[model samples]
Target: MRLEEIVIDNLRKLRRLISVRRMDDAEEAACKIVKYIFEDAPVLGLDLDGTIDEAPEFFRLLSRIWPGRVVIITCRLDEDKARADADKFGVFYDELVTVRKLEDKAEAIEQTGVTVYVDDQDECLMDIPMDVTVLKIRNEGNFTDGKWLYSGRTGKQIC
Candidate 1:
C-alpha cells in the first residue's frame, strides 16, 4: 500500500532566524492544513526545532482532527537540553525524540512510519529515502494569503 502520512520538519531552522518577525500566512496555511487533517485524505506531521513557542492551539486543533496519529520530530543535539526545552514549551507529543546528526532524518522518519516530510530546508532532507517526499516551506509566491505577507510590510499600506 502507498503511504499517506505527514511528517513536518524545519521549525527550528525557521525559528532561529532573528530577522524574521512574524508569519502572516502561518495561520492561513495552518487553517488549510487543519481542514485537510480532518478529512484524513493525508495524515499530518509536525516538526519543531525548539525555536518557536509551543503552539498549544495548533496541537489542540490537530489532536481534534487526527487524534493519536500526529508525530512531532525534533533535534536538540543534547538530550538534557531537549528535555529542558520541552518542559519550557510544554510540548506534549507522541514522540519527542532528539537526534544527534542531520543525516539521521530518514531513519527517524522511518521509525515514525510517516510518508511525507515537510521541511523548510530542502538541502537537509534531499538525501532521505525515496518513499519519503520532502516538501520545503517556501518564503512566498502563489500561496495566496501566506505568512510572508507581513515579512517586509510597514504600518501604512502604500496605495
Candidate 2:
C-alpha cells in the first residue's frame, strides 16, 4: 500500500478502537481513505453474473463499445469456471480478478485502478473506496429499488 493509504488505514483502526460514539471520526477516516484512492484513467470494474450474463443487452453493448477499459471482478471461487463462462458468453475485458468474499470486491476494484464499477450487488458496492463511481446495474435477482441503478443507457455515459 502507499503511504497515504497506510495513514488512512491507521486512522480507521484508531477510529474503531476509540468507540462507536465517535462515528463521525470513523466516517471522516473512511472519506479520507476514499479521497486517496482515486486513479487517473477511467478504468471500469464489472461484475459477472447479473451485471453481465443476466443483462445480455448491456453486456453485448459494452463488449463492443468499451472492451479495453473493462476489468471483470467476481467473487467466484473457481477462476477457471468463471473464465470459461466468460469466454462462452463472449464477455470482453482487459483483465479478470476473482475474490473469495463478496465484500472483498472493493479491494479488487481498487486493485483494478478503476474509477467506475458496474455491479448488481448493493452489498458489494457499499464499502468500496469513496472516489470510485459505482454504477449499479439492474438485475432481477439483486434489484430492491433504483437507489444506485444507472440512469443512462451506455457504458461510456456510465464511465
Candidate 3:
C-alpha cells in the first residue's frame, strides 16, 4: 500500500477506536501513524516568525524526533536574524529559505518538495497546493475561524 493509503487507513482506525472508547487501541493506532510518517522521512516545512518563535522548544524537540529533513521557510528579509533565532532556540533544520514575498512561500514549498508544512499565517497556508498537507498553527492573531486539521491556543501539539 502507498504511504498515503496507510496513513488514511490508520487515521480511520484511530477515529473508530476513539469513538468506541477504546483508548489503548486508539493510542496504539496513533503511534503507528506517527511511526509510518517518520519512517517515510517526509520533508517537513516550518514557518519561522509565528510558528517557531511561538514555541521554539516544541519545534526543537520535533526536529530531534523527526528523521526527515526540516526546512524553515520564511518571508523575513533578514536571514541573519532568522538564523540567529534558530541558533538561539536550538531548532534543528536542514535549510532556511527566505522568500521575497509571503505569497512566494507556495513556490518555495514546491521547489523544496515539502510534503507537510506548518505555518500560522492564513495567507501563506491558502496558496499551498492540495498535494502538500498544511497544518495551521492556531493563534490569536490568525486562523481564528476555519476547519483546520488541528487547533490549539499554544504552539504545542494537543492530543
How many pairs of residues collide in model 1?
3
Which lDDT tens digits does candidate 1 get at residues 1-159? 112233122233234332364554343333333443444344344556522233545454543445334455665567677656655654444555566665566677788776656544333464667876666555333135754232232223466
At residue 158, candidate 3 shows an lDDT of 46
Worst 10 residues of 1 by lDDT: 1-10
Evaluation by lDDT, superior candidate among 1 and 3 = 3
On TM-score, the candidate that comes out on top is 3
Q: Please give, for residues 1-159, the per-residue lDDT of candidate 2 as tens digits.
A: 885766678576657846766764564455444434554447778889888888766674565345246788988999999888877776666788999998899888887787888888777887789999998777666445753433223212434
- C-alpha lDDT of candidate 3 relative to the true structure: 0.82
Task: Please give the range of 10 consecutive residues that has the lowest summed lDDT in model 2.
Answer: 147-156
Q: What is the lDDT of residue 30 in candidate 2?
A: 53
TM-score per model over all chains? 0.45, 0.61, 0.65
Each model's lDDT: 0.49, 0.72, 0.82
Better of 2 and 3 by lDDT: 3
Q: Tell me the alpha-carbon RMSD of every candidate.
A: 15.8, 17.7, 12.3
Off by over 4 Å in 2: 1-41, 144-159
Worst 10 residues of 3 by lDDT: 147-156
Q: How many residue pairs collide in each prediction?
A: 3, 0, 0
